[model samples]
Target: MTYEDLPTVPRAEELVDKAFSRAARAGRAKSGAEAQRSMLQTAGNILSDNLQNVTTSWPDFDRVDPFYRELADAVVPAHGDCPGGVDGLRTHLSEVMWAGRQAGHIRDEYQSKLRGVDADLARKHRKQAFARLADVTREVSEDLEALGEARDTLKTLPDIRADQPTIVVAGYPNVGKSTFVNRVTNARNEVASYPFTTKQVRVGHVERDHVRYQLIDTPGLLDRPEAERNGIERQAVSALRHLADCILVFVDASAECGYPVEVQLALRDELADRFADIPVLTVCTKADRSRDLDADAYVSVTEEEGVEELLDAAVEAVDYEIELPFEG
Candidate 1:
């Protein structure tokens, strides 16, 4: 389900150069007419093999986790750079693979034609084979470049466990979401008072009553509507919606986080609408500086208060139940 470990995709020129260079070395290993024939076949085989590596190394979009699928599906083409969305990427990747397969066919045909040819003519045929395969390589260059851009985009995707019961923390920027995550779970991820400090989802784990649970620290969701969100922000939201077993919607009751309670409430309402499948446990944060506040849960992360109680609430909201040992 993780793409960060995938092998690097070579640029078009790099792929071509590597194939030709290796072919030359392999060609020199032979003598006379056979040298040119060996070189031609070797060059074609290298090109096909290298391109095959790229296609095989990439994760099959259909076979990946649903959370990953949603993330990939959310990737929009860069403005004026690529022309289509996730399906476009899928088609381009297939095209690159097709070109690779064609290279092998071209090589086989030239090798057959090499039979009974003189050394000088064999050399000519070898050059012709390289040119033909090179043309196929050129046909796939744009798709390769697009795949490269996809790799860069996918690098930002968070590493999350699919089996665990996950609790996603969400609210407007600077609403103590990160602080709450740090306080409740073993995760010591970065916590700051600044807005948008968490640009991606961060995961942590904790055990309660002998059962483990996952805590997700999501990027702060702005109060604005979904239309205003850019691609990166949309991807983060996709992770939350697709992965959360339960959601902890933090509210800044003290209004010290610059954004008002109304704005935070709007965010909570939006989340409720978007993720209707799971229960949203609304919590008021910064209780130390709080006056009157209204929420289903409340906690002061700075004062180390109500942290476990919040975890207990999240554990209750999960859809499944676990059996603990008998008190006897």
Candidate 2:
């Protein structure tokens, strides 16, 4: 959705009030399951930016070891004693994962499943084999349980229906904050490699597992005081005061700042004073290009681990609830 689709701030505020009023009249279902679901959905919203990184990576590791263990239970006797049994099982399981299920209802159908075997001569033995499939079935169930747990762990991300999480990406000019948002969110916001490419604050929705968060890509850091008649710095100041839910302070932890870490820390201090209530996350951008950037704080790896961690932090925002007598 675009700016046009979203109500103007004043209108949106009015709607929120109206919504709460309506909610007040309805009886609340304070069930623990309901609360757990709401919280997980909300957390999913905050971590939307990093959900793929976390959730996708999770199932991969989560399923692998269990899948191999299950395979060992099923295949060790028939496929007895491969030199590196676990490793071989892992390789086979990887292939199966990539292969996915067979097409359509045939995937669930078992009639033609033993097609490759010479079943005509081995019918009774086949019956005996089917009876012994219990161990394999049990192992398969265990593997599935591991994958389910991983998905559930991600599904339990923090969320509250009334207030959504917001992450403000602030940094020195050209630190790839916009790119980071795009990578995690599949957002199409414009990005440039120049300082101050983003003059205005652009808010994008990062939704994961049905939860939503507002990812605010703000202008670069404001070094000069507000009193100084300024340029990009002023835009940054405006974003600080008005737009962010939580501040993600992006530093040139790589020090393309042309200055020193002292200057960066001073800037951070100034920002803290200005936006004292907003939580600030330090982000060190430009791992691909700048090696000189030193961040004793959270460092971003040009575009990989650094940006990934930043997104996880964005997802980790706390949610608040008023415990309304009517919430369901």
Candidate 3:
């Protein structure tokens, strides 16, 4: 909840104000009896209204639904037969406040570490590397446009030519990354009926406009696990770690690995962490239907999707490797 929702008990204010007024007008209570009585009355007032301030001042508990339930349970005992009563909610709120602050601190600490060498790299030659890729991407786009027009004019399709025609279609499995390779490259590869079924690597190549990209369809990635016992995944990670240059990360927004868009974000963070500076692209493969997942990184490849655009993005994605001395 926002700051407005936090509880605000007037404990010191009520006690101080009355004491001040008596001191200003009637002078100090010489016997200290009046002072003791005033203190007791103020304490009673503080106890009576303490619950309202506690509940109101506490941040919104909507995100942590269980916390609110606990607060209600704590309140019911003291307020059993009374109207708008309050019990141990203040004590509970105190606990909640401590935990919340601790969580915030932890979250902020970890998030700072996740940003990577982006800042230092950005300052040095990393920015230049990305800028060079962007330039190449623009150039490739213009070249593709010319090629498309020429193909239409000649009524012929371009074919990919490679020595081995190895295409490593890297992405999270179940995103039809293999299926796209099979369809476009016409590779005789297995198309799984389930997630992570293509537990092996398959490579194929398709050429367009005299450009041949060997599509290597790789096993799915479970970002959380390393020794996941999936050989295909091991091979895929090996490629990501040491072999491949152009990487495509497939996402099934419909099939959220966890209940949040943040989970997918975490997956992205893992990818960026593992493969820094690699040319990676995102493929939204399950666009045939809508899922609640909202991602900033993807080129859609669903039914009636823009295959050309996807291909174009793929071109741009790989241009990073092409402009470099690295060979995929």
Candidates in order, TM-scores: namely 0.88, 0.44, 0.42
C-alpha positional error of residue 148 in candidate 3 after TM-score superposition, expressed in Å: 49
Instruction: Select the stronger candidate by lDDT from 1 and 2.
Output: 1
Task: Provide the lowest-lDDT 10-residue window in model 3.
Answer: 153-162
Instruction: Please give the clash total of every predicted structure, in order.
Output: 0, 12, 15
In model 2, the Cα lDDT at residue 91 comes to: 42
* lDDT by residue (tens digit), candidate 3, 9-38: 333333234433443343133223333333
CA lDDT, every model vs. true structure: 0.81, 0.46, 0.46
The TM-score of predicted model 3 comes to 0.42
Candidate 2's displacement at residue 73, Å, is 69
- Report the number of the highest-lDDT candidate: 1
Residue 266 miss distance in model 2 (angstroms): 1.7
**Local accuracy of candidate 1 as per-residue lDDT tens digits, 1-328:** 8768766777778878888898889877997779888887788888888788778988877788877776676663643355555677777778889988988998999999888889888888889889888899988888888888888877766678787788988888788888888877777778777877876677788887777888888777786767897555666587677788899988888888889898889888988998898989889888888846678887987788888898888898995677668998
Screening candidate 1 with a backbone cut-off below 3 angstroms (N, C-alpha, C), the clashing residue pairs are none
Please give the distance, in angstroms, between residue 223's alpha carbon in candidate 1 and its true position after superposition: 4.0
